[model samples]
Target: MCVNAGKDKESAQPPGCPVSRPVPAKPAQRPERVSLLSYLLRFRRDILSAQPARLYRAWMAEFRTPFFTSFLCNDPDLVNLVLTERPGDFPKSGRLFEALQPLLGHSIFITNGKEWERQRRIIDPAFESGRIREVFPAMWDAAVAAVGRLEPLADGRPIDIEPQTSHVALDVIFRALFSIPVEDRTASAVFDAFRAHQASRPMINTGSLLPLPRWVPRWRARKTKATARIIRGLIRQLVDERQADLDAGRAPDDLATRIMTTADPQDGSTFSPEEMADQVGIFLLAGHETSAAALAWALYLMALFPDWQARVAQEAEAVIDPGRIYFSTASKLKLARAVFRETMRLYPPVPMYLREAARAERFRARDVPRGAQIIVSPWHLHRHERIWRDPDGFDPTRWDTPEGRESSRRAYIPFSAGARVCPGSAFAMTEGQLILAMILRHYRVALAPGHTPVPVAQLTVRGRDGIRLTLTPRKTETP
Candidate 1:
């Protein structure tokens, strides 16, 4: 029998209830089953709203749709086991391949099996630890060039940092790869085409959850073709120039030249013209966009957290000399490195990573059926309650502590993890810290009045309207 509280009829505990306090009545429920389309639509609606992560969590709790299936793996060992331990059993989703095929077309990021191994053999040697220092001069040159361009900005005036960071990142990619500066006309045209392509890449919501044919996206197809033509043409020009040089036995030591000369050990093969175009396309898209997004977010975070910003500035001051910034000095600024790590934790440029079950598998006693699409989102992993202390709070000091270091590396994956992890990860980290340090050496950045940087997950995680900050030159000349 139910018992009402003496004060109010609804406040009393029910008879035979385990707890002394009244059990609240459950909400009324509808008997109707939600269709897959409607469910996907609802999920999309939640993603578009603010607090997308929360929306993602709630959807994952219910059904395991294609979208959620990929996003629901917040468990640590489970993710590790899938991505690192037994990667052979879990490949990138075929659906994802289908979606990006027009743009990427069997690129390293999406391919698997013998083909992926063959590509890795050639690319891995180029990005190994020993060659990193060899590329240092190129990185330094690009950083200095970028900072010089920003020197003309009015002190204490607000500047949109995306374009500034984009220029620097593009410059780095250009100089490192082509051994040439990025021309304004070329940069403008290429960036414009990419922007148009990004916009045309289809609205990623419930629609992405549906298994639809590729030809259904007419506008997207057109944009893809146009973007491919513009960028591929540029890539072809660079490749032809490098190939001609290589054939003449006079190729330079730049990345383009290296890629042209390097052959796969497994197959003793070099990239064909079409294959080279794809590789260059990856470098152009993944290379610049990831770095630019991270640096932009890092700057915005610096402005938002002035204490950390001040610490970074102080570290830069100690390491960088007046009138000149050196790449070797970047090694001495550990605090700045920690702050960059924390910023990445708070705002990873890429949010979701997708994989598919190649065959039936078991993960922690749960059956992962064959063909099950799996998603591992850094967005959720970085913020999971069990993985971090004060997960929601912005605290750079957390990274300095031993617990923070272990926890972060285990949970924090701004560049992702496993075999398919971004090859440009180290290059990006070095570039980001160096650029941030160089920029702070010259100017103090603060959030502009009435400006709020809102995080949005687009092709990359970026500020919805761009990060705007006030840049003021430091007073007192130190010669």
Candidate 2:
């Protein structure tokens, strides 16, 4: 689910289940001032821990690795320049394209310039704010399904929640996009293959560090490639079928239909099956994987901090009538939205955004050269010592304060910003809010005994051993 986590777990473990993503190295394993070779070695293990802790406080930090001269920019101004003000100057990095090429091909997520813009032009219509309300029923169904699935597991015992969240999130994406439940044969195949793919795709390959040309052959793991093919192949079949339905004028009015039917604004050209598949592939990943991460983390946050949980549950109870769900209800979930927002602040789904500096630029009086790897780390920025007060604390109410509003305006980008910002930003937020509120409304979550979740960023911010929480059905009306 993590689109890019640098390398992956080095194991030949069976790939049918949810992959236990990499955990952070113990402090003893991560010493200060390591050699470039050691850094690369450690990156393959856990990319975040490989860096010095000072990155949490530094405005701008530079790393001179052989692969590229890199700068991790925490300064708000620099982040704006790269992502918002002058995005063309800092397109997506080539390394990201290389990492995701196996699954995404040349989808908008990894492409840049005219091609990326064109894809956005065609794809954005389906995800516009007004269009999201149309998909609310699918999200609600997914949430209701989640409640049913958790009913059996709502005993006093502890269970890992990551898998459940992943399952429900994938279900939401499937229903919303293709109007098919995740249990549908083809949809199930894609989901199972993805669980298998996560184990194989420690994204970085032998060619990761090398300055190889696009034409050069890159090494990808045999299993990684195989799983990627299976996933994409299944998606291709899905889009092809959808295209046929569209031709016959019987396509379900879903996200896939809207995307495939909407011609590119500039060219007035529709996407071919292959192109639609490519976009859909990224959609499944971005939509499903990231949503799962947000939900899982929000649940864990509720478990660890019950006061906030109570507040959100009360809000959910007040806003949502378990009897029937309405799209308007999503707009009324204020506390749930705040909690989800806070969860992302503490653990950004895509931990970092990598952009290559197209031209040499100076930042905070430091020289930056063309070809430098520009890193905008939400993981660090959200908790930057110089930025937010009590930076590491989980306080959903922070979003309501005057200071919080100012800081959010300056910082707070769970989804990256500007022209290349996630087209589904609004959709993701509404989904996150509604689903989270719905879950807490039916069940109370608490931290599993002796199983504290340690935050680690991979594909998305995940617990070191998966988040284990104890679930109990709320005695009130069940939704």
What's the lDDT for candidate 2? 0.84
Total clashes, candidate 1?
2
lDDT (Cα atoms) of all candidates against the true structure: 0.69, 0.84
* Tens-digit per-residue lDDT, 195-271, candidate 2: 77876655345366678888888888898889999999999999889988988999999999999989987889988
Error of 2 at 204 (Å): 4.3
Model 2 superposed RMSD (Cα): 8.9
What TM-score would each prediction reach against the true structure? 0.84, 0.92
lDDT of 1 by residue, 1-479 (tens): 75534323433567575333221111122224666666455434323222234422332322365544543577777778778888888887776666566666677877889888887777777777666677777778877777778778737888888878877887788778877776655555666666666555532433445567656653335665677677667667777877888889887798777776689976689888778777877787787877888788778777766667788888877887755645567678787787777777767767777788888776656677777777777776776667787675677789878988888767777877787777778877888898888787767888788877666666676666778888877753432
